[model samples]
Target: MSSISNRIEQISSSKPGAKDYINYLHSLSAAADLISYAKAIIQIPDGAIVARPVLAEFVSYTKGLADAREEVLIATLDVLKEKTIIFEEQEFLAREALAEVYEQKNEFTKAARVLQGMRLDSGQQHITDDQKVAVYVRIVRMLLEDEDDAGAETYLNKCALLIHKCNDPAQKVHFKLSQARIFDTRRKFLDATRKYYEMSLEEAVDADDRLQCLLAASKTAILSPAGPLRQRVLTALYKDERSVQLPTFKVLEQLYENRILDQEDVKQFAEMLEPHQLALMGDGVTVLHRAVLEHNLLAISRVFSCISFPRVAALLGMELTQAEDTIANMIIQGRLSGRIDQVSGFVYFDSEKSNLNVRQKALVRLDEVAERIAATSRDVRIY
Candidate 1:
């Protein structure tokens, strides 16, 4: 220990460069003398040029030390920042290390602030776009972890711009996935679903990533507010060949076909979901429960012109009042085109008229085609 302290003192007194400082720090780390090294680094004069790299190296070396003190690490970083001109890249690295330590210590706001101070342009293109992307991603994650969705989104946009500058396909996909997650966090399910679905189609994305994206898209589509837009998105996903073999495909198909989703089916599907997927989609039990109700309502709209409230309740496995409330909510949301008659205790489906109108329009189009064909035949005969 005396020898190690002597070596550190000699290195610090000599005004070492970055390489020399790093080498000495590695020796201390290898000797398991990080405490002595940390004390020596902190004692270096604040304006000493050697202090920059020494403090940066101190931050890195002490980072993984289970017993390393936070104050020592932070004080080292503060000195590194003071000598920014000589530090340059070392300053960035030191700040990043400091931020990471803050995060590990659960000081998320401090972590975010440390990273936010790192200006990518300071390196003047010396820093790779990938590095810029990485920093922005960290900041976004920290902000998000701190429950600052709006702040995370601001960094998300910045990260996006840097992503385009990078040549790494993986980095681009990473940014996209992060962006989709932000949308998900914001409860913009449609936007999140669209992003995921689009990513699933990208040939550049790896198969595993594509599969995950498709699964996310399908789940978010299910969670999207029930509407024609939701139906269109689900239909597209249902027809996607890549999704056909995934376990979630069946759930999507069942929902798209307006088939009642049974508890057993949902349990089977839930078992297939990844832990993150299940968490992101919320409680699988409740999700399936709601899906069953939605499926029954949709099926009723498509099949039955009129049904007694008791029958509706039986089909949905809910009581009369519960069924009435669910159906009424669906109706008000424009998910179910129907009305309930309190006096008659009957629910009438009005979507059938719309279906009839669609068929009539198709018939009129066919008649127009027939008339055009006849006109063309007469013209040929006259010629």
Candidate 2:
């Protein structure tokens, strides 16, 4: 306690123009008591403005001494955080540098926790929106790396509120990538596929990075529930020339071509999937099971006009009751282009009707868009 008091008195009583106090800490560096001095200086009364230079000089002075660098930062932050009026700029710099140290050590949660403790998110904290988004993006990135989705999501939502206002295009890309990750983790494959594919097309992104995004799009498209919504993203990915480079390309190719997936094909694709992807769904079936069955059902309609329920069950490797129920559900959802015949033990295909239904849906969407535009125009005129 006396050493701390003497350190504060020295800084307070030193000549105003001379930064001898910084030199004083440097003198103690050889003695390895620099941190004790840094801690004491931060406690100076109304010394918020003086805090940044002391921390900055200490950071510079401790260069090459890795252990001392961390100690100096920790000492400065510990004392500064307790002060009612914090020195914001130095605090930001110290936390960021500390987070970098933890990140390099593969301590992702610690890195995120260090940044999450910053005051930048508060209304009173004076910082640009881009700056705020940058820190939030870093926090989200580390949280995701730690596989803490719930925590990542909490910070990601904060980023969303300010991301659009940000001028940094690079930050925007990072934000979008984080969003794709969150969506993928949550099993919202269709949305993830769209975001990934969209980012892959960006000219600003590096070629390797773009390809990685494209690969993610391909993988998620295969993982998505087979339906019109999934089909749209799949079609986009299949048409993208870069998707051919992905290991999942064969699966995407067969799925898009409506070719019946054989056991070998399914096995190859399953080998590439993550453990969560192979986990059982609520229906006592794996995600792969549902995707394969739904897709093969569509493929059957492409090959034969009609098929017996028993043969359908044999082709899909399912029982008669499950085959009937799956076909019925597909028909009800307007996914499969066929109707089931329980009495005749057959299913009938209607390719033309399915095309008509899709066209009708397109027109319905166009009508809704037009209505919204017209309503907007009316509101503008009233205003």
Top candidate (TM-score)? 2
lDDT of 2 at 287: 78
* Candidate lDDT values, in order: 0.72, 0.80
Give the candidate number with the greatest lDDT: 2
For residue 356, model 1's alpha carbon misses the true position, in angstroms, by 11
TM-score of 1: 0.71
Once superposed on the true structure, which residue ranges of model 1 sit more than 4 Å away at CA? 1-23, 30-75, 81-88, 98-130, 142-151, 157-168, 271-288, 352-383
Model 2 poorest ten-residue lDDT run: 14-23
Per-residue lDDT of model 2, residues 1-383, tens digit only:
57756866866775442276666766665323766666676666536566558767766666556665676667767766765245666677778888887898899999999998888755545799999999999999999887788899999999999998999999999999999998887778888888998899988799999999998888788888776677788888888887888988888889998888877978988888766668887879887888899889888887889999999999989988888888888888777767777789999988645644566679988999999999998888542
lDDT for each residue of candidate 1 in 52-91, tens digit (9 for 90 to 100)? 5566556666666554545555654565554456556766
The local lDDT score (0 to 100) that residue 165 gets in candidate 1 is 83
